[model samples]
Each structure stands twice: as C-alpha cells, then as structure tokens.
Target: MGDEVPGVGAHARYVPGRFADQVALVTGGGSGIGAAVARQLAAEGCARVNVADQDMDNAESVAVAMGGTARHVDVADADAVDALVSGVTRDCGRLDVVVHAAGVDDPEAKAQLLSAREAGEPVDVLARLGDERWRRVMSVNLDGTFHVLRAAVRAMRPRGRGAVVTVGSSAAFDTLVGYPHYAASKAGVHALSQAVAKEAIAFGVRVNTVAPGPVDTAMAARTPAAVRAAMEAAGAIGYASAEDLADSICYLASPGAANVVGAVLLSNGGRFTV
Candidate 1:
C-alpha cells in the first residue's frame, strides 16, 4: 500500500500500492462489480486500466471517471477480444492484470416462475429456459472468460509475469435451481481458471477465481425478496458489497498474492464457508 494513491476519490477504501505501474484490463467494467473493481484498481495506483464493456457509453463513463481508457468489446467474439488486448498492450506497453466480470441474469427463467405463480403458466415450457438461453449464458460467463484469458496469457507469457482474476459465482458450488445455466457456466469458469493456472505456473503467471455470493449489485436487486432474505439469513454477515469483492480481486492481482495460485477466493459473507 502507498500514500496518496492515484484514482481514489472520496469514497474509496484503504489505498494500496499493490498494483503500482501495472496495466489492468477489466471486462464488464461499466457497472456493478466490474465497475467497482476498476475503481479500486485505479485507486491502488495501476498506471493504466482499460475498462471494457459491450456498451461503449457506459464503459467510457467509467474509464473517464477512473482516469483510465475505455474500449468496447464483445467478449464472446474471440477476434474482438484479441484485438482489444493487442490494442491495450500496444498503447500501454505492458499488461499485468486481467479481470473478467462480464455476466447476465436469466430474466426469462424468472419471468416463467413469476407467471406460474401469477397466472398458472406452465413453468416447464418457459421461452427463456431453453438451449438458446444456456448457450448465451455460457458464451459470456465461460467462453468469454476463455477468450480474454487466452489473449492475456499470450501477452503475459512473453513477460513471464502476470495475474488473472476471473469472476465466478457461489452458485458454482451451490444449488441454484432456476439459474442452472448460470451456475454451470460459473463452475466452468472455476475449472478453466484452475487449468490455466496449472499450465501457466512455469511461465510465472498466476490465475485465480473470485466466487462472490449474493453481492448487492443489480443482479442481486433482481432476485426475489424471499430468496434474498434467505441468502442473507444463511450468511454470517448478512450481505457482501461490490467493494468487498473488489478488495479480494485487488489482492489476487497484487504481489502479495504471489503464492496464491490456482485458488478460488470466496467473498460470500460466509454463505459458502469451508
């Protein structure tokens, strides 16, 4: 940690020098947990941060606020992800951290359940709980992570040093009935990160995952009140905020976590206590 860190505005927590001079690229950096992580990293003194998202306007707002750069990237598109990586490296000179936080919720699944309760609609035949939904969820959560990690490793291996923090979900290890697809994709993310860490150790790269539980983000806002209450009651600390998860991501991206490779750091307010 250092004094007078770069991008810490009034609201940031303890400023840390963990990422001084590092260049970080955060996907889905426009809002919620991704945005919080970006702000935290910038506050910690990373020299350059590329805040990327599918929405350029949102991304630009975040980047500008953070005093960083913004890039529009569709993570599902491997070519676009590669180009974004190349562009960031070309412009910034080096890459040190990669944080993938892009994600989506199953609105259709939620709708079907709501309809079943309200109008006696058959929940099994919901339009949103099908193959297409599964594909989209996996495409962004798992495949998108792969695309970014692939490009980042290509850049990091040459330097022989880098850190990657992928965002997973507590659902990966728990039973989340309506969001089976989301849970499966996040589980795949954990497995993928572990495999990457195993292969990358020799190259001096570390890959880890952060599986957050019921974070107070837009996603959590969409959860039913009863479900949210249940999650909160089950947790030792009731709720975890985006910044709480961001702190863990920052730690994984730091030199202090050098020995912490291929690990899944759970920031779930004791919801999935080991």
Candidate 2:
C-alpha cells in the first residue's frame, strides 16, 4: 500500500508519481474492480478521475470518496459515451488514461447452469443460457468497451500520447462454461486491445489489457462454494485481490509501460498463462 497525498481541491487527495498530473477516466468505477482502480489511481496522484457508470449514486459515491468527478453515462449508449469523453476533457483539460472495468455476471443463470452440472446433466440443456442473456452480456462487456475505446481513442490520438487499459477475464483463455457471452465478450476485449495497440502506436498512444482470474470481489464471492473451489484449483495462487488487479491497471497506464503495447498482462495467480 502507498501513502495518501493531498487532493487538487478540498475534497480530493493525491497519491504520487504513479499517475501524478495525469487525467484518467474509468467506467464501472462505482464498485468491484472498477472502484479499486479509481482508488488506486487517485492515490497515485492522478490530477482528475472521472468515475462514470449507469448507476449515478454509486458513481457519485466513488467520486466523492476519491474527491474526483462522477458522471452518469451508460457505456452502451454511443451518444452518452461521446458526451462523457468530451465532458471530461473540457472539465479536466486532458485525458491520459482510460480503464474499462464495467461488467455483469448473471448469478441466477450461473446457478442454474451449475445445478445442471451437479445433476450430471448436459450444461447446454439449461434454458438459462438464452438469447436475451447473451445479448445483455455482450452489450455491456463487448459493445460497451467499443463505445468507450472509440471515444477515448478519438481524444487520445490527437494528443499523440495516452494509455488505454481494458479489463478482460481469464475465462477468455480458459474453459469457463455456462457463460459463453461473458467469455466471448472478454475475448473480444483482448482482441480489440491488440487491434487498437497496432493503430494507436503511430500516434504515441499505447493500448494494453489486464485479464484477472478468480479475483476476490463481490462478483466472485457470489459464486457457489463448489464453483469457487474449482476456480481456485485452476489458479496457481488460489485467489487474487482487487488491489492486485488494480496495480496491473495502473502499471499499464503509467509511463513505465511506454515500451509495452498490445500486451495482455495476466494477474491471475498463474491460473492461465497467456
């Protein structure tokens, strides 16, 4: 852990060179991994952080806690995302980093699928895996990422210097059944980062991703004990903390990663080597 520094205003505090003087925008910054990222960046001396999420209360809470700005914008909405990017730049002057961490995991569907597995039934037999579920998952995880990345790159490219870090999942590489939508969306995220890196490099902007495995967040905590055990067995170190993943996000966003591009840094405790 690092010591906390003073904020730019009476409500904010600064961390140090980890992100000193830089402006960062984080989606899904209200809770889970997103909240951790926001706290870490704010601690690292980021001049301003815009914590955007569809949940205004959660976003505002995180913003107030970090002493940063909070905005309500659904990443799935292109216009909302565009306005958000513009608003941040106008208010904060410039944007240096963008971290996409918003995601959804349907527990009911997961539980139903897991039950089928327990009953020795074919996983695909479960009706929980429906078109609506798939669409909802993709809309948030895949399409939402595209919305944010497109908007951020537009702003970042002109500046000739910026960093974009998308949060992916170990499931993208490993065998995590029952949620094909989540897996597919994460796969798209990694692929998108690779593509972005190739194009952004010419403009001095770097793009990378961090895929975490079995992190000890609320989402993972909601998993059944058996499911959690299975996931832990796949990891070399059992489980990871939100801070562990947050550190990787910050690293990819910092100057130290100038030479690192299109890299998918895995902080999965050796669960999946990619």
Candidate 3:
C-alpha cells in the first residue's frame, strides 16, 4: 500500500489451526520478526507460546497481548538457555516447536565507526574491532544457538519428534555490510543448523535455518538510507517484511517441511537465486 508496488499487498493475517494443539517457544520475541512469529503461532492456535527475550518490558507486553508467557532470558548464557527449555518443556508437558530468533546488534560500536570515519580517522574495521565485541556477538549468535538447539534436541529425543528453526542472516553468505564478527557468527549458525539437523533426524527431530535478506528491522536502521534502499531494490520482492520471514519459519516447523532437513531456506526475495 505504500507505493503501488507490484508484489506488495495486504499482509497475510492468519493461518488458522496451522499449529493447533502445539506448544511453541520463540527467543527474542519482544519485537521485530520474533514478535511477529510468536503472534502468528498464537493466531494459528498454538496451545501455548513462550515469549523469551532479554527485554523484560517488551517481552511482557508481547506475551500479555498474545495470552502467552514471558521469560527474561539472555540467550548468550548456556545455563539460562538450558534452564529455559527445560522449564518450558516441563510446563508445556511437551516442546513441539522452537524458533531461535534472538540476536544482538551493537549500535554503539556502529556509531563509533561512523564517527571515526567522519573525523578523517583510519577505519580498519577488523583492526579496530574489539575482542569483547567479537566474543559477545559469537556468544549470543553461535553459542546461544548451540545451547538452545542442544537442549531442544535432547527434549525432542524423548518425545520422538519435534521441529527447530533457526534465524540466520544472509550476511552468512554474502553481505556488503563488512561486519566480520557478525557475519562469521551467522555463518556458524548456518553450519550449526545443518549439523544439528543431521543429528536430530535420527531421533525424529527436524532442524532448519532461515536466512533472510534486506529485512526492515531496527537493526537495519543503522545502515545508511541509500544502502538500505539499494539492497531492497536488488531483491525480487523489492523489500522484506517480518511476516514474510515468519511464514517461511512456520512452514519449516510445520509438518509441511517434514522432508526438509539440514537445508538453509535463503529467503532473499530471489536476490541470490540458485
């Protein structure tokens, strides 16, 4: 509705009963794509949705609106992540679906890089990258994935069935942003997803990764307007929406994706089509 865009139209509102009787958990469900996915699950008749996020206020808001539950969790902490899954499994009586959408973006560091560039200072992104930033990013993006997937795998093992969908970035493959740490962490997520999928399949559990591009999110705001516009135009759909991404995720977690495993669904709006 914004500009008579060819592929743009009213958002798909509901997938009624798509997840009836299911219990789902979404990390980073406070806002953005995570919140969208959680809401979609609830709309689709999920028996329960655990809205896990580091932001207590936002998480609580989303949970209350959806009539789910909120848990303040830092995905970077393995112990916390494990405990979360275990508790959810205990409360829900079964963990049927999990979407690892939780991630981080250091706006402060981005501001520094831009400020240094404006000041005519040499901006060696890698050389200037701090060890702390790299570690923190990896911990949240890669290690956090490990913690959740591993614990979920174990829980699903006893049930003999479950589905896990992870959120990866298109940066894992080709991104012009030039943020090595973030890119690498996402790449790790890609590989980890594939490996975990292969391992979980033996126990009737499925895992997949959704790598989206040019998403209109708060994190993407840090990029220059020109850069963002160019990226959007390059995509086949001309833009990315959180709801669209959630659809792919829901599909993967649903029985429709039963045959799909160890695959990375590159939802780039056909920007890098195979």
Candidate 4:
C-alpha cells in the first residue's frame, strides 16, 4: 500500500485501519513489543484496547494515551488471566481479538552469567543456571500463554468467532547461547499455539503466533554489546524495531489472515526463516 499512520507509543509505526470497530485485549501491554502492539491495535481502529500487564503504571500510561482501558494482570496465574478475560468481555460486551505478548527473562541467569565474568570466575553456564531460573521463565512465557489462550477460547467459543495472536521469539528456532530457559520457553510457546489452534478451530477461533528475532527492546539490551554487534553483523537484516513485530501481529489478527491458522508469522529480519 506504500502507506503509514501514527501509532500509540514511541516504538510503534503507522498502519491501515482494518481493525476498526473491533475490541482487543493485549497482555504485557506495558512496554516493549506488547506496548507497541497495543498502540498498533488502537491506531488500526480498535474501538477499545485493554492494556493488560503486571506493571499497572506502564499499562495505564499506554492505555490512557491510546484511549483504552488498563488492567493489572499476571498472566502466569490462570485464575487471574481468566478474570481479566471475563472482565473485559462483561464490560466491553465482546472481544474480537486477543494478542498475548507477555514473556519473562531469567534474572538469575543474567546475574550469574554477568557476575561470573565480572569477577573473573570461570563461567559455567549450566552451573549458574539453576532449576528455579528455568521454571520461572517457562512459567511466565509458556504457561502464561497457555492460560491466556485457554481463557480466550472459553469466551470466544460462545461467540463462535475470534482471532488470537501470541508473540514468540526467534530464539525458539535457534540458539540463544547463555539463555537456554528463555529459548525453551519460546519453543514451547510455538508448540502450544499450534495445539491450541487445532482445538480452537472447531469453535471458530483462530490462534497463531508471531516469532521475532533480536529486536530493539529492553530484552535485547541484556546481550553484551560486543556480542550483539557481532551477531547483528552475521544476520541478514540484523535487528528490527518493535513496530516491525507489531505490524506482523496486527496483520495476523486482521481479516486478511482469516485462513492463517496454527501458523507462525516470523518477523526476524531475515535472521531465522523457520
């Protein structure tokens, strides 16, 4: 179309208004790709966008600026996820689309990996990465996705038509080196989305995922600058902005993607094509 439009946050980009009149709920809408997704949804003509995140302040900031509602939620908690979905449906009357952008990092992995290098200690990646770190990341990224998808299906089944887009990572298909937990969680996310798509299809709900490579986000900042630069040099298109990923997500949720079920729309800037 060779066109563009204003987005909600500093990270988003312009897009068409195919989403007009739809109601969307975006989890992890406080910042990064999630924030950008909420903004794109708003700019694309969503009548109401519920910005759900554990960080109420950021969620509120994004929601208020975009003329949508803010919600405090921990997607890892099944009950809380269900409640958020119910509340949005009860108040907004219907949820035409859902985008799950909530994912977590392994703080323990980062701290240990960085500290060992800083202290001149022999870096043992596995030794430093405890079981807790793995579980925590999986809980938030994989389990949380399951919870949100399940809840959304329950609500959408009654309506008999809906669309869902979950944000995943290119790391799932490649190596993330020191962050095995994060990689594993994202891999599970892709598998889970496909499984859910199969189940939800019978209910008229289509579920899919957008897997982006190293994008310019706080999460990417965790990588050592030297390593990031080296990786970028090897990549076909290097890193992309949050808006790029958001653009793909909005496309998947829009009517143009009505038949793109159980698919993973990879927006990795040509780094990983799978």
Using lDDT, give the best candidate's number.
4
How many collisions between residues are there in candidate 4?
Answer: 1
- What C-alpha lDDT does candidate 3 achieve relative to the native structure? 0.84
Candidate lDDT values, in order: 0.85, 0.84, 0.84, 0.85
Clashes of each: 1, 7, 0, 1
What are the per-residue Cα lDDT tens digits for candidate 4 across 77-102?
99999999999999999999999999
TM per candidate: 0.91, 0.92, 0.90, 0.91
**Candidate 3 ranges beyond 4 A from true positions:** 1-13, 112-123
Runs of candidate 1 with Cα error greater than 4 angstroms are 1-8, 113-128
lDDT of 3 at 133: 88
Pairwise lDDT winner, candidates 2 and 4 = 4
| Residue 28 in model 4: lDDT | 92
Which candidate wins on TM-score?
2
What tens digits encode model 3's per-residue C-alpha lDDT throughout 109-222? 555556655687754577677899889999999999998899889889998999999999887878544478888999999999999899899999999999988777777787
Predicted structure 4, TM vs. truth: 0.91
**Model 1 residue 52 distance off true place after TM-score fit, in angstroms:** 0.4
Q: Considering only N, C-alpha and C atoms within 3 Å, which residue pairs clash in candidate 4?
A: 5-14
